[model samples]
Target chain A: MKRTVPLVITFIVGLVLIAAMFIPHWPFTGLDSKFSIFYDVIAVFAFILGGGNLLKVHLSRIQNRRRDWKYSIVTVSGFFLMLGAGLLKIGVPGGWTGDYQADGSLLKYLYDATFQPLQATMFSLLAFFVASASYRAFRAKTKEATILLLAAFVILLRPTPLGYYLTFWLPKPLQFLHIPNLSTWIMSVPNMAGQRAIMIGIALGIVSASLRLILGIERSYLGTEGKD
Target chain B: MAEEEKLTIIERLGAVDRRYVFLLIAIAVIIPLVLHYATSIPTSEIVQSLFDKIESLPGGSRILISFDYGPSTVPENQPMANAVTRHALEKSHRIYLMALWPTGSRQSQQLIDEIIKVEFPDKVYGVDWIHLGYKAGNQGLINTLLSDFKGMYTTDMSGKPIDSFPMMKDIRTLRDFDLIIGLGSGFPGTKEWIQFAGDPGDIPVGGGTTAVMAPLLYPYYPKQMVGFMGGLQGAAEYEYALVKKYPKYAKRSRIASTTMGPQVTAHLVIVAFIILGNITYLLERRRKRKYR
Candidate 1:
């Protein structure tokens, strides 16, 4: 009964939402939006629990002096500092009435000064990683691999002035076969077709998985046996 | 000498430390950035289509610019955002900025504070541009905005009422806008816009996404999206077009083009390394064959 009740509720709600998309009747017309608001409301309350859990876990790690607990100290401090600054409206030039995102506020200051730059710094590491990964992995062992290598070479050259120069001397009839032009064709035609194919497969998979869930066949998600 | 000869090119390459390769790439990036190199990147049609879309739009046509990315993507997406906003503002299009990602709102505000306020001070707020900030429901926000934008954005980014903004007066729905462009790095971004609003409302849409996200969005081009700018390269190309057409702004900020020098150099370094790695691989294979 413990699992059965929840499954029933899930089936009913899920079916209703699915039906709502196409029906557009009295209850169904705005049900998707109404449920979205319901989700937002629930999410707001869930955030408090989420925030509390974050604080608890990080604080415990710091207290116990676990491995890399020092990083937790930074995380806990940043969390509370931003929260307090935002909630108390601390150091906001517009005082209590203004937007929490107002300039001269501690929250905004920290976000701009620390968060923005730090995020950019983390992302910039991708350049090094991509270079290292490509050096080690981009080998041409097979016909397919050779094609891939050639494509990569063309794509790499396409964005640079070097690409323009490489094939610039070609005759007018062969102008469209230039590296830059080939790059465009590769992205728009083959790339688009591949993406679309993947998207279609994903859509079909979702439908199948969703149906399984609806029928209670996807019981793995429920954390216990469906028969139980 | 025979022992040295026995060492295959692959063995020699294997002995070469990875740090040297990293140092070479580092030099490649730094040199191009420090020294200005004249690089004429011919505008691709995809980029030109986006340029033409803005160019043809009648002045005062509402153009909604959605800042759908956060700080992690700022380097890639921000320059494109700058170029797009600059072009739209240059064309005298009324701007309405919004965001799907929570941090996207802040990123959008950065553009306004940095570019809009400083460069185009003559452009009045409310009348010229308004920021709807962010709404939480991702696709649901688009769903609501399709029918009634007022349902979601009752106020501007600040604590000001939307009614006060002259630009907000007529924007009852997404359909009312002349064009909607999304600049994002991931899900709930251009894909969401393409599916939810653009397809349903038949509104012209465009995207400026990170290169990683660009390939995924191509199916929508010319049909769902009029055009798109892909990553820093796209940003650079658009910047080139903008500057070339309006030579007056050639001296103004050009971040993408500046970054492209490093971009091109880095690509070359990677390509060279790949070739070197392959040579080692082939030599090793050949040596194994001879032994067999």
Candidate 2:
């Protein structure tokens, strides 16, 4: 009964929101906003579930003396310390009344000194990964591969002053053979076409996924079997 | 070689060493960037459309500029934001700034400080422009603002009331603004702006986004979205247009074209790697067939 009630509510709300998109009138105009507020309220409650899971996982790891138990200890300690600092407003000038990130506050200090740098470092990893991925994926072995390779070459040359120099000797009518022109053609036409195709696929995928959820065919997010 | 006794070139081509490709691509990207190569590629129709939107807006039209991206996409998105801001300010358009991302608020503040506050001190905050600061409700804040602008955001970044500002008097919803510019990177970004604000409100919206996200937005162009700038190349084109139209901004900012040098080189490197991979696959196939 507990699960059934919530599922019923979900089905009704989900349909209403979808229908609201087409309806331009009053109450319907505000329906989307109200639904968003409702989702926010539920998400706030779900944070408790997340916190409980975090505690359970780390505590069990520490108690079991699991591999990398010290890491668990650090995680648990840091979690509590941050929580306490935020809840109690530790080292915040003028106590809890002032902004948590007010200049000279401990929260701000920790964020700037520790969190900001950590975030930046994680983001920087993308550059290395892009290089690695590009190296492996960009290979040519067939007619299609050769075409892709050549297109890539033209695109690459088009972006540099060197491209202009290389194609400078070409006649006025043959200027279209320049690397820059070739690159622009590849991106605007071929790239745009590929992007549109992928977008359509993604859109269809999203529609299928959303429909599955609305019809109660996808229950995995509820921590249960896929089938309801 | 007999068909049953030997592998074909196509099969061999499929089995190339990936490392060789990677190495080749690295060379392709590095050489151009190191050499400081520059090219003057003619602008595309899409980029020109975006330029026209800014150009057509009457001088001093009120525009809302939302910086909805963070440092992660600063490389791709910042140039567009700067160029658009410069274009608007140059046209004498009044700007109302806001951000959905927490970090974006600070980013917006930085732009105001660096560009408007410093360069154009005569541009007053309340009358000429205002920063509504960051709101945490994501699209919900946008949804609310559709009906009640003051309900969600009562004050500006400096604690000034919306009512106190003369510019915001008739601004009951997003429709009041002449144009809505969203510089976005990911979720709760340009897409969300289109869904929540532009489509329903019927407001004309245009903006720039990271290359990765640009593909997803192409379907909405010239329809829900007036125009869009994609990646570093798009930014360079916009920068090119701005400098040619108003040379004053040419000195103030050159973030887009400067970054294009690296971007172009990187693209070339990727192409080279692909070619090397193909050649290696073909050669290995030939060698294997001979032995068999």
Can you tell me which runs of candidate 1 are displaced by over 4 Å?
Answer: A1-13, A41-50, A63-65, A214-221, A225-227, B2-9, B38-40
User: Mind giving the per-residue lDDT tens digits that candidate 1 earns over A1-228?
Assistant: 768877786787678767866786767646655665555456566678889999999999999999999999999988888899889989987788878887889889989889889988898777777887677778899999998889778889897777878998889999878888888888888778988899889879999999888877777766856565
Q: In candidate 1 chain A, where is summed lDDT lowest over 10 consecutive residues?
A: A35-44
C-alpha lDDT of all candidate models, in order: 0.84, 0.74
| Candidate 2 residue-wise lDDT, A57-168, digit = tens | 9999999999999899998987787677666777877776655555566665666676556666687556555755555566555789668767767755665666778887
Give per-residue CA lDDT, model 1, range B187-251, as digits (tens).
Answer: 78998898888997889999899999988888788878999899888888888899989887786
Categorize the docking of model 2. Answer: acceptable
Candidate 2, residues B1-292: lDDT per residue as tens digits?
6764444644554555555555655565567567865533455666778888888999878889888877667777777878888888878888999987766775676688677888779888788888887876677767767756776677777566788998888788777888888888887888888888899889888878887777677767778888888877778888888888888776666777766766766665655455545565666667788899
Lowest lDDT 10-mer window, candidate 2 chain B?
Answer: B4-13
lDDT of 1: 0.84
Show where candidate 2 strays beyond 4 Å.
A40-56, A59-63, A72-112, A143-154, A165-177, A215-218, A225-228, B1-43, B137-141, B158-160, B267-271
